[model samples]
Target: MAAPAVVRDLREHWAPASAQEFMLDDVDLGNRRLTIAGRVRPLDDLTLKLLLDWLEQRRSRWPNTANLHLLIHNQTADTTGRASSHWISAAMRGQDAPLEKLRVDRQLEEALPHGPDPLHLAEVFGLDEKTPMRYADSARALMERPLETDPATSP
Candidate 1:
């Protein structure tokens, strides 16, 4: 509730109307990839492990349920529907950082390493063209900034 805008994507992700087939399309463990916005993003070992664990729990808790969503709560376990929007907010109520900040930080992290390749950043993070360019520019500026001189050490 504190950061409502930050959880907009979470709401959409947990929306009851989300296509079950897309959940399958989103993850490919064999290939270690995640598809977001039609972009195939590679999954690191840690992410794969966490996803596997979640999948195991989901299967164990709701083995008899018909819900096919990647994420579901008790309210949705018995049906093909998903958890409600309030559930999404409550789930993230005590998070250390806002989701939007995490997303921006991730983009900045990617941009800092490859500012010269805005296209790659855009593709990797599933971002629009301009956003990546802004990140790339900010990263380049940070990298190219001159170091401050120490008066005490001046010759």
Candidate 2:
């Protein structure tokens, strides 16, 4: 039997491409869709983040890098033109209004230049540029496991 394909640790087999720096903007996650500066097809935000993190890591190691991207749509109004507040509420489980609008830009900043922030990822994983792919992989894996009230913090 052929040996199972060994998936190399992204850190080991990863190398950034010699491509121009691609700009990512107007990212709207309200509906988990994004409209990249120039591209097509609505990409999942989580997927984009994972790829971006990997690319950034590779870039740090290899200055010359190439990147790929796809445009996505954030459809706020539904097919019937109804507000998504009801859906959002149902998703939040009657949580505080402020909590519902939680976007952790600052939390992401803290998690960078060191390593993953267990405290932040413990709640929700953000595929922001600051995150590392290895960290993201671990965080996503942990989602399946039982939640630990107390999570480790980045030093």
Candidate 3:
């Protein structure tokens, strides 16, 4: 819950590569930042609290374990390895949306508010240099479209 929640809230990638690479040190609650894939992104209050609680539970369950991954499970708790990429999906099986969809929705949410600024999107999301431009273009088109009016009210 905490992992998927963070992914949805912060627009961070939780794909196979990222899921298998997350470390406890990547989350800096004191600084309210998460360093993932070389991107140091801010963490919201709700997400921060969730993480803190999760950490407390983790410590209680595996006090002597040496695993450093933030999302450790029953099988990976004792080793210094990350959970498999499918871990997020497995954990989110009954959730409203998949982790990937959450990330896309988050990107669109950000793009709508900050479109025409692909550079900002790319910088914030660590997207491929050209990827943010696509989202920016979509935002631009959506913004340019006229709003619908009721036929009865139309002149």
Candidate 4:
């Protein structure tokens, strides 16, 4: 499968583990929000709509699942279990480490454009302030560097 498809499948498989809940009603569609480990976060309109549609379809397919958890194994009937950090690391078994690179690229891009407000980054990305602060420092150093230009190559 393509990388994007793999990522999407992994994301869907991991959603219940990340959110720590199984009930479709746990998601507050009317408010366009979802809670992750007790922290409430707003959802983009597209995500909210897609989730609603998925839930509706799931409900129709499995009416008895209304009171049960959202993600259940088709054969085993077990809740989608959480993956260990070791499992995640093994899953990204590649020299390039695409997931790590994507995270770093996103942080740098966010920092470069905004001058790196660590607090803002923490709130917006639902991350710890320390991580954003580190990104902010990197951004500051990058902003201080002068661009190197060669006079010989000037047009």
Return the top candidate by TM-score: 3
lDDT values for all models = 0.63, 0.33, 0.73, 0.55
Clashing residue pairs, candidate 2? 17-64, 17-65, 17-66, 18-65, 19-65, 40-71, 42-72
lDDT of 4 by residue, 38-155 (tens): 6666665555666666566656655564235443333312334432334333434564546656566666766788886897667655777588888888888888899878989978
Question: What global local distance difference test value does model 1 have?
Answer: 0.63
Tens-digit lDDT track for model 3 on 1-155? 33445433433444556756768889888899878787887765776977787788888988998998887777888788777766655555677786677777677777887756799778767889888988888788888889989999999
Instruction: List candidate 3 segments past 4 Å from native.
Output: 1-12, 94-99, 149-155
Candidate 4: give its CA RMSD in angstroms. Answer: 5.7
If the candidates were sorted by their TM-score against the true structure, best first, what order would they fall in? Answer: 3, 1, 4, 2
Give the distance in Å from residue 142's predicted Cα in candidate 1 to where it truly belongs.
Answer: 2.4
TM-score of each: 0.72, 0.21, 0.77, 0.54
Off by over 4 Å in 1: 1-22, 146-155
**Higher-TM-score candidate of 1 and 3:** 3
The TM-score measured for candidate 2 stands at 0.21
- Residue-level lDDT of model 2, residues 1-155, one tens digit each, is 11101101111111111011122333343444434323222333444565455445444643432323211112311122322333322333443533312333333333453345564443333334444454544545554566566545523
lDDT of 1 by residue, 1-155 (tens): 23223124333222323322235447799999867556687765666776677677778977887776676667777878755545555645576876567667766776776665789877776667788788888788888899889999989
| Pairs of residues at least 3 apart in sequence or in different chains that clash in candidate 3 | none
Candidate with the greatest lDDT versus the true structure: 3
